[model samples]
Target: MYVMTLTKSDFEAFKELIKVTLEEQTETFLATKEDIKHLPTKDEFYSKMDEIMGELKATREEVVMFSDLNRKVNDHDERIEKIENNCVILFLFT
Candidate 1:
């Protein structure tokens, strides 16, 4: 069991409190019109994300190609060194 009493001023104050709370909650859940204009739309965001991903993929492919080329060049350098050493030894003997 509960006993409750409300003066007229108290009731008016409670009403004002409820009104303020509702306004604050509404603002929290919903952005203002100005805020919406500054934000990107969903489609625009996704389009930009897709463009970035494509660029990233292309960059990755280029890195892999350059890495392979570097390895091949290193292998060729080793072979060239071995050939040069063999030539020097043959020349010394002759």
Candidate 2:
């Protein structure tokens, strides 16, 4: 388990960067398909396809990580709210 502390601005920046990387990878894969004839050999095309698949897997892992981080942050926020409410009630009774 990993804990990540991020401000709103930082999270937005991180999301933007991830979005751009995914878009670039998608474009590269599409462009490669169009240029496959220049690959010169069957083995070369297969190798390039393997490389693209690896990139896609990595990008997917990044997306999953981002989602997990978002969930954890939301959970933390909820816990903080509960604590704050309890504190307010305690002060009112005292």
Candidate 3:
């Protein structure tokens, strides 16, 4: 173990040093009242978020509709191909 000693003056100086360092750190880390003055209100934030969610919901609906339409078109194409094949077979037989 090591031993250390501080004179009264040295202790006083150390306390002053800690006080100044704490003040500086507090200023650096803490926000002032003016810093947050321009921030939006809670209602404004919620309103904007609701708008964005609405747009996203609309986009999702459109995508679902497009997917359903594409599936129908594919089904029709498959039916057309089967009809064409049947007609070709009938012609060959005749």
Candidate 4:
């Protein structure tokens, strides 16, 4: 056996709590809608991607130029080494 009792004041308090909760939920939903409106769209996303790819292309060109410059420096170093070797051989023979 169980006995329960709810007073008029208790019902009023419960109603007030439900009203406040519903109001807060509605406000939260409206705030979320405002946030969604400010989110990036598909066109904006594509523009960002294009900007990144442009930067990447520029970086790739710079890398190719650096690689070519490095190869030239290596070739110059090899030539200098060969000349030094020849000089040493000539000095030893004479």
Local accuracy of candidate 1 as per-residue lDDT tens digits, 12-44: 999999999999999899977887898789999
**Tens-digit lDDT track of model 4 for 1-94:** 8988999999999999999999999987775656779778999989999999999999999999999999999999999999999999999999
lDDT of 3 by residue, 1-94 (tens): 9988889999999999999999999999998779978988899999999999999999999999999999999999999999999999999999
Residue pairs whose backbone atoms clash in candidate 4: none
Local accuracy of candidate 2 as per-residue lDDT tens digits, 4-93 = 889999999999999999999998777555586565688877999999999999999999999999999999999999999999999999
Whole-model lDDT, model 4: 0.95
Q: Looking at model 3, which ten-residue stretch has the lowest summed lDDT?
A: 32-41
Per-candidate Cα lDDT values, in order, are 0.96, 0.93, 0.96, 0.95
The segments of candidate 4 whose C-alpha lies over 4 angstroms from its true place after superposition are 1-35
Compared with the true structure, the alpha-carbon lDDT of candidate 2 equals: 0.93
Poorly placed runs, candidate 3 (over 4 Å): 1-4
Each model's TM-score? Answer: 0.71, 0.55, 0.78, 0.54
**Prediction 4 TM-score vs. true:** 0.54
Candidate 4 lDDT at 10 equals: 94
